[model samples]
Target: MRVIAAKEFSDRIRNRWVLAVAAVFAVFALAISYFGGAQQGAVGVQGMEVTIASLVSLVIYLIPLIALMLGFDAVVGERERGSLDLLLSMPLTRFELLLGKFLGLSAALAASTLAGFGLAGAMLVMQWPEGSLWHYAGFMLSALLMGMAFLSMAVAVSVVVADRARASGLAIALWFFFVLVYDLTLLGILVVSEGRLDLDFFPLLLLANPADVFRILNIFSLEEVKTLYGLATVIPEAYTSPWLLAGIMVLWMILPLSLAAWKFK
Candidate 1:
Protein backbone atom coordinates (compact mmCIF):
# COMPACT_ATOMS: atom_id res chain seq x y z
CA MET A 1 0.00 0.00 0.00
CA ARG A 2 2.72 2.42 1.00
CA VAL A 3 4.75 1.72 -2.10
CA ILE A 4 1.77 2.16 -4.39
CA ALA A 5 0.81 5.41 -2.70
CA ALA A 6 4.35 6.69 -2.88
CA LYS A 7 4.62 5.84 -6.56
CA GLU A 8 1.30 7.57 -7.29
CA PHE A 9 2.29 10.59 -5.23
CA SER A 10 5.58 10.88 -7.06
CA ASP A 11 3.89 10.57 -10.42
CA ARG A 12 1.44 13.40 -9.59
CA ILE A 13 4.17 15.73 -8.32
CA ARG A 14 6.19 15.04 -11.43
CA ASN A 15 3.28 15.59 -13.80
CA ARG A 16 3.06 18.78 -15.87
CA TRP A 17 -0.72 19.02 -15.43
CA VAL A 18 -0.44 19.50 -11.67
CA LEU A 19 2.02 22.33 -12.15
CA ALA A 20 -0.12 23.98 -14.83
CA VAL A 21 -3.30 23.91 -12.77
CA ALA A 22 -1.47 25.25 -9.73
CA ALA A 23 -0.11 28.09 -11.83
CA VAL A 24 -3.58 29.02 -13.06
CA PHE A 25 -4.98 29.26 -9.53
CA ALA A 26 -1.96 31.23 -8.28
CA VAL A 27 -2.21 33.78 -11.08
CA PHE A 28 -5.96 34.27 -10.66
CA ALA A 29 -5.75 34.65 -6.90
CA LEU A 30 -2.94 37.21 -6.97
CA ALA A 31 -4.28 39.22 -9.88
CA ILE A 32 -7.75 39.54 -8.38
CA SER A 33 -6.44 40.49 -4.95
CA TYR A 34 -4.01 43.09 -6.30
CA PHE A 35 -6.54 44.89 -8.47
CA GLY A 36 -9.32 44.51 -5.93
CA GLY A 37 -7.13 45.68 -3.04
CA ALA A 38 -6.07 48.90 -4.75
CA GLN A 39 -9.70 50.03 -4.93
CA GLN A 40 -10.69 49.31 -1.32
CA GLY A 41 -14.06 50.74 -0.34
CA ALA A 42 -17.29 49.28 1.03
CA VAL A 43 -17.87 48.79 -2.63
CA GLY A 44 -14.30 47.55 -2.91
CA VAL A 45 -14.63 45.33 0.14
CA GLN A 46 -17.81 43.83 -1.24
CA GLY A 47 -16.07 43.49 -4.57
CA MET A 48 -13.02 41.89 -3.00
CA GLU A 49 -15.20 39.70 -0.81
CA VAL A 50 -17.24 38.73 -3.84
CA THR A 51 -14.11 37.89 -5.77
CA ILE A 52 -13.07 35.47 -3.05
CA ALA A 53 -16.63 34.31 -2.65
CA SER A 54 -16.81 33.54 -6.35
CA LEU A 55 -13.82 31.24 -6.01
CA VAL A 56 -15.45 29.46 -3.09
CA SER A 57 -18.67 29.11 -5.06
CA LEU A 58 -16.78 27.53 -7.94
CA VAL A 59 -14.84 25.14 -5.71
CA ILE A 60 -17.14 22.22 -6.46
CA TYR A 61 -16.91 22.72 -10.20
CA LEU A 62 -13.20 23.46 -10.31
CA ILE A 63 -12.09 20.60 -8.08
CA PRO A 64 -13.90 17.99 -10.14
CA LEU A 65 -12.55 19.51 -13.34
CA ILE A 66 -9.02 19.15 -12.05
CA ALA A 67 -9.70 15.70 -10.66
CA LEU A 68 -11.07 14.38 -13.94
CA MET A 69 -8.22 15.96 -15.81
CA LEU A 70 -5.83 14.17 -13.50
CA GLY A 71 -7.65 10.89 -12.91
CA PHE A 72 -10.15 10.10 -15.68
CA ASP A 73 -7.16 8.29 -17.07
CA ALA A 74 -6.16 6.58 -13.85
CA VAL A 75 -7.22 3.07 -14.80
CA VAL A 76 -8.38 3.40 -18.39
CA GLY A 77 -5.45 5.49 -19.50
CA GLU A 78 -3.07 2.84 -18.23
CA ARG A 79 -5.19 0.17 -19.85
CA GLU A 80 -5.20 1.95 -23.19
CA ARG A 81 -1.48 2.52 -22.95
CA GLY A 82 -1.07 -1.23 -22.29
CA SER A 83 0.32 -0.71 -18.79
CA LEU A 84 -2.60 -1.93 -16.69
CA ASP A 85 -1.97 -5.61 -17.43
CA LEU A 86 1.53 -5.27 -16.02
CA LEU A 87 0.30 -3.25 -13.01
CA LEU A 88 -2.26 -5.89 -12.10
CA SER A 89 0.32 -8.64 -12.46
CA MET A 90 2.22 -7.06 -9.59
CA PRO A 91 1.59 -8.01 -5.94
CA LEU A 92 -0.52 -4.88 -5.30
CA THR A 93 -4.28 -5.42 -4.99
CA ARG A 94 -6.87 -3.38 -6.91
CA PHE A 95 -8.04 -1.71 -3.71
CA GLU A 96 -4.52 -0.51 -2.97
CA LEU A 97 -4.17 0.80 -6.49
CA LEU A 98 -7.45 2.69 -6.40
CA LEU A 99 -6.86 4.04 -2.90
CA GLY A 100 -3.32 5.09 -3.67
CA LYS A 101 -4.43 6.94 -6.77
CA PHE A 102 -7.25 8.62 -4.89
CA LEU A 103 -5.02 9.69 -2.01
CA GLY A 104 -2.26 10.97 -4.26
CA LEU A 105 -4.70 12.91 -6.41
CA SER A 106 -6.28 14.28 -3.24
CA ALA A 107 -2.87 15.40 -2.04
CA ALA A 108 -2.28 17.17 -5.33
CA LEU A 109 -5.57 19.04 -4.97
CA ALA A 110 -4.82 19.98 -1.38
CA ALA A 111 -1.34 21.23 -2.21
CA SER A 112 -2.51 23.31 -5.15
CA THR A 113 -5.38 24.84 -3.20
CA LEU A 114 -3.22 25.57 -0.19
CA ALA A 115 -0.36 27.11 -2.16
CA GLY A 116 -2.61 29.32 -4.28
CA PHE A 117 -4.84 30.54 -1.46
CA GLY A 118 -2.03 30.66 1.09
CA LEU A 119 -0.17 33.11 -1.12
CA ALA A 120 -3.36 35.02 -1.84
CA GLY A 121 -4.23 35.19 1.85
CA ALA A 122 -0.77 36.52 2.67
CA MET A 123 -1.02 39.12 -0.08
CA LEU A 124 -4.46 40.25 1.06
CA VAL A 125 -3.36 40.55 4.69
CA MET A 126 -0.30 42.55 3.67
CA GLN A 127 -2.16 44.75 1.21
CA TRP A 128 -5.04 45.53 3.54
CA PRO A 129 -3.99 45.71 7.15
CA GLU A 130 -7.57 46.12 8.36
CA GLY A 131 -8.92 42.94 6.78
CA SER A 132 -9.80 39.90 8.89
CA LEU A 133 -7.17 37.15 8.74
CA TRP A 134 -9.37 34.78 10.72
CA HIS A 135 -12.21 35.15 8.23
CA TYR A 136 -9.86 34.45 5.31
CA ALA A 137 -8.43 31.37 7.04
CA GLY A 138 -11.88 30.05 7.82
CA PHE A 139 -12.99 30.41 4.21
CA MET A 140 -9.81 28.80 2.90
CA LEU A 141 -10.45 25.81 5.13
CA SER A 142 -14.05 25.55 3.96
CA ALA A 143 -12.92 25.67 0.34
CA LEU A 144 -10.50 22.80 1.00
CA LEU A 145 -13.26 20.49 2.20
CA MET A 146 -15.45 21.49 -0.73
CA GLY A 147 -12.60 20.64 -3.07
CA MET A 148 -12.21 17.23 -1.43
CA ALA A 149 -15.88 16.42 -1.92
CA PHE A 150 -15.65 17.22 -5.62
CA LEU A 151 -12.46 15.20 -5.99
CA SER A 152 -14.20 12.22 -4.44
CA MET A 153 -17.13 12.70 -6.79
CA ALA A 154 -14.81 12.70 -9.76
CA VAL A 155 -13.03 9.58 -8.54
CA ALA A 156 -16.28 7.70 -8.09
CA VAL A 157 -17.45 8.65 -11.55
CA SER A 158 -14.14 7.72 -13.11
CA VAL A 159 -14.26 4.30 -11.51
CA VAL A 160 -17.84 3.62 -12.58
CA VAL A 161 -17.52 4.69 -16.22
CA ALA A 162 -15.32 2.62 -18.53
CA ASP A 163 -14.77 5.16 -21.27
CA ARG A 164 -12.35 7.92 -20.27
CA ALA A 165 -14.14 10.61 -22.24
CA ARG A 166 -17.51 9.63 -20.88
CA ALA A 167 -16.20 9.66 -17.32
CA SER A 168 -14.70 13.12 -17.76
CA GLY A 169 -17.85 14.39 -19.43
CA LEU A 170 -20.08 13.00 -16.70
CA ALA A 171 -17.89 14.52 -13.99
CA ILE A 172 -18.07 17.94 -15.63
CA ALA A 173 -21.82 17.72 -16.25
CA LEU A 174 -22.49 16.80 -12.64
CA TRP A 175 -20.45 19.78 -11.48
CA PHE A 176 -22.28 22.15 -13.84
CA PHE A 177 -25.65 20.92 -12.72
CA PHE A 178 -24.82 21.24 -9.04
CA VAL A 179 -23.07 24.57 -9.26
CA LEU A 180 -24.86 26.50 -11.99
CA VAL A 181 -28.33 24.98 -12.09
CA TYR A 182 -28.95 23.56 -8.62
CA ASP A 183 -29.40 26.86 -6.79
CA LEU A 184 -31.50 28.34 -9.58
CA THR A 185 -33.74 25.29 -9.42
CA LEU A 186 -34.00 25.56 -5.65
CA LEU A 187 -34.83 29.25 -5.85
CA GLY A 188 -37.50 28.51 -8.42
CA ILE A 189 -39.06 25.99 -6.09
CA LEU A 190 -38.97 28.44 -3.20
CA VAL A 191 -40.52 31.16 -5.33
CA VAL A 192 -43.37 28.93 -6.47
CA SER A 193 -43.96 27.66 -2.94
CA GLU A 194 -44.00 31.12 -1.40
CA GLY A 195 -43.14 31.65 2.31
CA ARG A 196 -45.33 28.78 3.50
CA LEU A 197 -42.30 26.62 4.32
CA ASP A 198 -40.81 26.99 7.79
CA LEU A 199 -37.39 28.63 8.19
CA ASP A 200 -36.03 25.42 9.75
CA PHE A 201 -36.58 23.63 6.45
CA PHE A 202 -33.88 25.72 4.77
CA PRO A 203 -31.06 23.84 6.50
CA LEU A 204 -32.58 20.51 5.56
CA LEU A 205 -32.83 21.62 1.96
CA LEU A 206 -29.32 23.05 2.20
CA LEU A 207 -27.96 19.56 2.93
CA ALA A 208 -28.73 18.65 -0.68
CA ASN A 209 -26.26 21.37 -1.73
CA PRO A 210 -22.70 21.46 -0.45
CA ALA A 211 -22.19 24.59 -2.56
CA ASP A 212 -25.00 26.53 -0.87
CA VAL A 213 -23.82 25.41 2.53
CA PHE A 214 -20.37 26.65 1.57
CA ARG A 215 -21.80 30.01 0.47
CA ILE A 216 -23.73 30.55 3.69
CA LEU A 217 -20.70 29.59 5.80
CA ASN A 218 -18.33 31.98 4.03
CA ILE A 219 -20.84 34.83 3.73
CA PHE A 220 -21.57 34.73 7.45
CA SER A 221 -18.45 36.86 7.91
CA LEU A 222 -20.24 39.80 6.33
CA GLU A 223 -22.07 40.74 9.50
CA GLU A 224 -23.46 44.00 8.12
CA VAL A 225 -25.42 42.19 5.45
CA LYS A 226 -26.23 39.13 7.59
CA THR A 227 -29.56 40.62 8.57
CA LEU A 228 -30.59 40.99 4.96
CA TYR A 229 -29.80 37.34 4.20
CA GLY A 230 -30.55 36.17 7.73
CA LEU A 231 -33.17 33.64 8.68
CA ALA A 232 -35.36 36.64 9.32
CA THR A 233 -34.76 40.21 10.48
CA VAL A 234 -36.45 39.35 13.76
CA ILE A 235 -34.21 36.38 14.51
CA PRO A 236 -31.11 36.77 16.67
CA GLU A 237 -27.56 36.38 15.33
CA ALA A 238 -27.26 33.05 17.12
CA TYR A 239 -29.80 31.61 14.72
CA THR A 240 -27.09 31.52 12.05
CA SER A 241 -24.18 30.39 14.15
CA PRO A 242 -20.79 29.61 12.58
CA TRP A 243 -20.22 26.31 14.41
CA LEU A 244 -23.42 24.84 13.03
CA LEU A 245 -22.35 25.99 9.61
CA ALA A 246 -18.96 24.31 10.07
CA GLY A 247 -20.65 21.05 11.12
CA ILE A 248 -22.67 21.06 7.92
CA MET A 249 -19.47 21.71 5.95
CA VAL A 250 -17.80 18.71 7.65
CA LEU A 251 -20.67 16.42 6.67
CA TRP A 252 -20.27 17.38 3.01
CA MET A 253 -16.67 16.20 3.06
CA ILE A 254 -17.35 12.88 4.81
CA LEU A 255 -20.40 11.81 2.81
CA PRO A 256 -18.84 12.13 -0.65
CA LEU A 257 -15.59 10.39 0.27
CA SER A 258 -17.56 7.50 1.77
CA LEU A 259 -19.55 7.10 -1.42
CA ALA A 260 -16.37 7.14 -3.52
CA ALA A 261 -14.67 4.52 -1.39
CA TRP A 262 -17.67 2.24 -1.59
CA LYS A 263 -17.91 2.65 -5.34
CA PHE A 264 -14.24 1.98 -5.91
CA LYS A 265 -14.22 -1.14 -3.70
Candidate 2:
Protein backbone atom coordinates (compact mmCIF):
# COMPACT_ATOMS: atom_id res chain seq x y z
CA MET A 1 0.00 0.00 0.00
CA ARG A 2 2.80 2.40 0.83
CA VAL A 3 4.54 1.65 -2.44
CA ILE A 4 1.37 2.15 -4.46
CA ALA A 5 0.55 5.33 -2.62
CA ALA A 6 4.04 6.65 -3.09
CA LYS A 7 3.92 5.80 -6.77
CA GLU A 8 0.54 7.50 -7.16
CA PHE A 9 1.76 10.67 -5.47
CA SER A 10 5.00 10.50 -7.43
CA ASP A 11 3.03 10.33 -10.64
CA ARG A 12 1.15 13.45 -9.68
CA ILE A 13 4.45 15.12 -9.06
CA ARG A 14 5.93 13.85 -12.30
CA ASN A 15 3.00 15.19 -14.25
CA ARG A 16 3.19 18.59 -12.48
CA TRP A 17 -0.45 18.14 -11.42
CA VAL A 18 0.23 19.26 -7.88
CA LEU A 19 1.94 22.44 -8.97
CA ALA A 20 -0.85 23.21 -11.40
CA VAL A 21 -3.56 22.79 -8.81
CA ALA A 22 -1.65 24.73 -6.19
CA ALA A 23 -1.19 27.55 -8.62
CA VAL A 24 -4.88 27.67 -9.38
CA PHE A 25 -5.71 27.71 -5.69
CA ALA A 26 -3.09 30.30 -4.81
CA VAL A 27 -4.25 32.70 -7.50
CA PHE A 28 -7.93 32.38 -6.67
CA ALA A 29 -7.51 32.44 -2.91
CA LEU A 30 -5.31 35.50 -3.05
CA ALA A 31 -7.80 37.22 -5.31
CA ILE A 32 -10.74 36.47 -3.05
CA SER A 33 -8.87 37.27 0.13
CA TYR A 34 -7.75 40.67 -1.08
CA PHE A 35 -10.89 41.75 -2.90
CA GLY A 36 -13.60 40.00 -0.91
CA GLY A 37 -14.99 43.26 0.39
CA ALA A 38 -14.99 45.20 -2.87
CA GLN A 39 -18.76 45.56 -3.00
CA GLN A 40 -18.59 47.58 0.22
CA GLY A 41 -16.80 50.29 -1.80
CA ALA A 42 -13.42 49.14 -0.65
CA VAL A 43 -11.00 46.26 -1.12
CA GLY A 44 -7.99 44.49 0.45
CA VAL A 45 -7.91 42.07 3.35
CA GLN A 46 -10.96 43.31 5.28
CA GLY A 47 -10.74 40.67 7.99
CA MET A 48 -10.22 36.93 8.19
CA GLU A 49 -13.94 36.48 8.69
CA VAL A 50 -14.98 38.41 5.61
CA THR A 51 -12.25 36.81 3.54
CA ILE A 52 -13.36 33.33 4.57
CA ALA A 53 -16.97 34.30 3.96
CA SER A 54 -16.20 35.19 0.36
CA LEU A 55 -14.08 32.11 -0.27
CA VAL A 56 -16.74 29.71 1.04
CA SER A 57 -18.60 29.58 -2.26
CA LEU A 58 -15.36 29.05 -4.13
CA VAL A 59 -14.45 26.07 -1.95
CA ILE A 60 -17.90 24.51 -2.18
CA TYR A 61 -18.07 24.71 -5.97
CA LEU A 62 -14.48 24.37 -7.12
CA ILE A 63 -12.76 21.86 -4.84
CA PRO A 64 -15.28 19.09 -5.41
CA LEU A 65 -14.97 19.37 -9.19
CA ILE A 66 -11.18 19.28 -9.02
CA ALA A 67 -11.13 16.27 -6.69
CA LEU A 68 -13.61 14.37 -8.87
CA MET A 69 -11.61 15.07 -12.01
CA LEU A 70 -8.45 13.88 -10.30
CA GLY A 71 -9.80 10.56 -8.98
CA PHE A 72 -12.57 9.53 -11.40
CA ASP A 73 -10.19 7.18 -13.19
CA ALA A 74 -8.08 5.74 -10.38
CA VAL A 75 -9.00 2.13 -11.08
CA VAL A 76 -10.78 2.39 -14.38
CA GLY A 77 -7.80 4.02 -16.03
CA GLU A 78 -5.53 1.23 -14.81
CA ARG A 79 -7.90 -1.35 -16.22
CA GLU A 80 -8.29 0.53 -19.47
CA ARG A 81 -4.52 0.59 -19.88
CA GLY A 82 -4.42 -3.16 -19.21
CA SER A 83 -2.31 -2.72 -16.07
CA LEU A 84 -4.90 -3.62 -13.39
CA ASP A 85 -4.41 -7.37 -13.83
CA LEU A 86 -0.67 -6.95 -13.52
CA LEU A 87 -1.21 -4.88 -10.40
CA LEU A 88 -3.46 -7.57 -8.97
CA SER A 89 -0.89 -10.27 -9.74
CA MET A 90 1.43 -8.61 -7.25
CA PRO A 91 1.42 -9.24 -3.49
CA LEU A 92 -1.29 -6.71 -2.69
CA THR A 93 -4.83 -7.13 -1.54
CA ARG A 94 -7.65 -5.33 -3.38
CA PHE A 95 -8.35 -3.29 -0.28
CA GLU A 96 -4.72 -2.24 -0.01
CA LEU A 97 -4.62 -1.14 -3.60
CA LEU A 98 -7.88 0.79 -3.28
CA LEU A 99 -6.74 2.40 -0.06
CA GLY A 100 -3.36 3.32 -1.43
CA LYS A 101 -4.94 4.99 -4.43
CA PHE A 102 -7.36 6.93 -2.28
CA LEU A 103 -4.76 8.00 0.24
CA GLY A 104 -2.28 9.01 -2.43
CA LEU A 105 -4.82 11.05 -4.28
CA SER A 106 -5.96 12.47 -0.96
CA ALA A 107 -2.45 13.55 -0.06
CA ALA A 108 -1.98 15.27 -3.36
CA LEU A 109 -5.28 17.10 -2.96
CA ALA A 110 -4.47 18.07 0.60
CA ALA A 111 -1.03 19.32 -0.32
CA SER A 112 -2.32 21.47 -3.13
CA THR A 113 -5.08 22.91 -0.95
CA LEU A 114 -2.62 23.65 1.81
CA ALA A 115 -0.03 25.14 -0.49
CA GLY A 116 -2.57 27.34 -2.21
CA PHE A 117 -4.36 28.55 0.89
CA GLY A 118 -1.22 28.77 2.96
CA LEU A 119 0.23 31.18 0.44
CA ALA A 120 -2.87 33.31 0.63
CA GLY A 121 -2.89 33.12 4.42
CA ALA A 122 0.72 34.22 4.62
CA MET A 123 -0.01 37.14 2.35
CA LEU A 124 -2.98 38.14 4.52
CA VAL A 125 -0.81 38.00 7.61
CA MET A 126 1.76 40.21 5.97
CA GLN A 127 -0.85 42.75 4.91
CA TRP A 128 -3.16 42.86 7.91
CA PRO A 129 -0.62 41.84 10.62
CA GLU A 130 -3.48 41.15 13.07
CA GLY A 131 -6.51 38.85 13.63
CA SER A 132 -6.99 35.38 14.99
CA LEU A 133 -5.04 33.04 12.70
CA TRP A 134 -7.31 30.27 13.93
CA HIS A 135 -10.23 31.48 11.81
CA TYR A 136 -8.22 31.34 8.60
CA ALA A 137 -6.76 28.00 9.64
CA GLY A 138 -10.24 26.64 10.28
CA PHE A 139 -11.38 27.71 6.85
CA MET A 140 -8.44 25.98 5.21
CA LEU A 141 -9.00 22.85 7.28
CA SER A 142 -12.69 22.65 6.35
CA ALA A 143 -11.76 23.04 2.70
CA LEU A 144 -9.42 20.06 2.94
CA LEU A 145 -12.06 17.90 4.61
CA MET A 146 -14.66 18.75 2.00
CA GLY A 147 -12.19 18.03 -0.80
CA MET A 148 -11.52 14.60 0.67
CA ALA A 149 -15.21 13.79 0.84
CA PHE A 150 -15.65 14.53 -2.86
CA LEU A 151 -12.47 12.68 -3.71
CA SER A 152 -13.77 9.65 -1.84
CA MET A 153 -16.96 9.76 -3.86
CA ALA A 154 -14.94 9.93 -7.05
CA VAL A 155 -12.89 6.93 -6.00
CA ALA A 156 -16.08 5.02 -5.31
CA VAL A 157 -17.40 5.99 -8.71
CA SER A 158 -14.17 4.85 -10.32
CA VAL A 159 -14.47 1.47 -8.61
CA VAL A 160 -18.15 0.81 -9.37
CA VAL A 161 -18.38 2.05 -12.93
CA ALA A 162 -17.33 -0.13 -15.85
CA ASP A 163 -15.30 2.47 -17.74
CA ARG A 164 -13.57 5.80 -17.37
CA ALA A 165 -16.22 7.53 -19.49
CA ARG A 166 -18.98 6.34 -17.21
CA ALA A 167 -16.93 7.16 -14.14
CA SER A 168 -16.33 10.69 -15.36
CA GLY A 169 -19.99 11.15 -16.19
CA LEU A 170 -21.11 9.81 -12.85
CA ALA A 171 -18.59 11.99 -11.02
CA ILE A 172 -19.86 15.09 -12.78
CA ALA A 173 -23.43 14.05 -12.06
CA LEU A 174 -22.59 13.71 -8.39
CA TRP A 175 -21.00 17.18 -8.42
CA PHE A 176 -24.01 18.71 -10.13
CA PHE A 177 -26.42 17.01 -7.76
CA PHE A 178 -24.55 17.89 -4.62
CA VAL A 179 -23.07 21.27 -5.52
CA LEU A 180 -25.93 22.66 -7.59
CA VAL A 181 -29.14 20.74 -7.25
CA TYR A 182 -29.25 19.47 -3.66
CA ASP A 183 -29.79 22.82 -1.90
CA LEU A 184 -32.26 24.02 -4.49
CA THR A 185 -34.16 20.77 -4.25
CA LEU A 186 -34.36 21.13 -0.50
CA LEU A 187 -35.59 24.68 -0.87
CA GLY A 188 -38.15 23.51 -3.42
CA ILE A 189 -39.46 20.87 -1.07
CA LEU A 190 -39.83 23.50 1.63
CA VAL A 191 -41.63 25.76 -0.78
CA VAL A 192 -44.01 23.16 -2.16
CA SER A 193 -44.83 21.74 1.24
CA GLU A 194 -45.64 25.21 2.62
CA GLY A 195 -45.07 24.23 6.27
CA ARG A 196 -46.51 20.74 5.70
CA LEU A 197 -43.02 19.31 5.43
CA ASP A 198 -41.46 18.82 8.81
CA LEU A 199 -39.19 21.79 9.38
CA ASP A 200 -37.45 19.77 12.07
CA PHE A 201 -35.70 17.50 9.57
CA PHE A 202 -34.35 20.23 7.30
CA PRO A 203 -30.94 20.48 8.91
CA LEU A 204 -30.63 16.69 8.79
CA LEU A 205 -31.46 16.86 5.09
CA LEU A 206 -28.61 19.37 4.61
CA LEU A 207 -26.34 16.90 6.36
CA ALA A 208 -27.13 14.42 3.60
CA ASN A 209 -25.04 16.55 1.22
CA PRO A 210 -21.43 17.04 2.23
CA ALA A 211 -21.38 20.35 0.38
CA ASP A 212 -24.12 21.76 2.61
CA VAL A 213 -22.36 20.41 5.67
CA PHE A 214 -19.22 22.19 4.47
CA ARG A 215 -21.10 25.42 3.82
CA ILE A 216 -22.53 25.40 7.31
CA LEU A 217 -19.14 24.58 8.79
CA ASN A 218 -17.59 27.74 7.34
CA ILE A 219 -20.52 30.15 7.16
CA PHE A 220 -22.30 29.71 10.50
CA SER A 221 -19.09 30.14 12.43
CA LEU A 222 -18.99 33.76 11.34
CA GLU A 223 -21.23 36.18 13.22
CA GLU A 224 -20.73 38.62 10.35
CA VAL A 225 -22.16 36.08 7.93
CA LYS A 226 -25.02 34.56 9.95
CA THR A 227 -27.72 37.13 9.25
CA LEU A 228 -26.81 37.39 5.58
CA TYR A 229 -27.60 33.73 4.86
CA GLY A 230 -30.49 33.71 7.36
CA LEU A 231 -29.56 30.14 8.28
CA ALA A 232 -28.89 31.31 11.86
CA THR A 233 -32.55 30.69 12.63
CA VAL A 234 -32.62 27.44 10.68
CA ILE A 235 -29.66 25.36 11.87
CA PRO A 236 -29.61 24.29 15.48
CA GLU A 237 -26.47 25.02 17.49
CA ALA A 238 -25.74 21.29 17.82
CA TYR A 239 -25.51 20.79 14.07
CA THR A 240 -23.26 23.81 13.71
CA SER A 241 -20.69 22.45 16.15
CA PRO A 242 -17.40 22.39 14.21
CA TRP A 243 -16.33 19.05 15.62
CA LEU A 244 -19.66 17.39 14.80
CA LEU A 245 -19.77 18.73 11.27
CA ALA A 246 -16.14 17.72 10.77
CA GLY A 247 -16.93 14.22 11.99
CA ILE A 248 -19.76 14.09 9.46
CA MET A 249 -17.31 15.21 6.79
CA VAL A 250 -14.96 12.45 7.86
CA LEU A 251 -17.86 10.00 7.63
CA TRP A 252 -18.55 11.30 4.15
CA MET A 253 -14.90 10.54 3.32
CA ILE A 254 -15.01 7.04 4.79
CA LEU A 255 -18.31 5.58 3.58
CA PRO A 256 -17.71 5.96 -0.14
CA LEU A 257 -14.11 4.78 -0.01
CA SER A 258 -15.22 1.90 2.20
CA LEU A 259 -17.85 1.05 -0.43
CA ALA A 260 -15.13 1.18 -3.07
CA ALA A 261 -12.94 -1.19 -1.06
CA TRP A 262 -15.86 -3.58 -0.68
CA LYS A 263 -16.69 -3.49 -4.38
CA PHE A 264 -13.07 -3.70 -5.50
CA LYS A 265 -12.89 -7.15 -4.01
Report every candidate's CA lDDT.
Answer: 0.66, 0.89
Candidate 2 ranges with C-alpha deviation above 4 Å: 129-131
What tens-digit string does per-residue lDDT give for candidate 2 at 1-265?
9999899898998899999999998898889877877888887667777778888988899999999999999999999989999999999999999889989999999889999888878878665545547777888899999999999999999999999999999999999999999999988998999878778989999988889998999888788888899988888888899999999999998999999999988
lDDT of 2 at 127: 59
lDDT of 2 at 200: 91
Best by lDDT: 2
Backbone clashes in model 2, listed as residue pairs: none
Each prediction's RMSD to truth: 3.8, 1.2
Give residue 111's lDDT in candidate 1 (0 to 100): 75
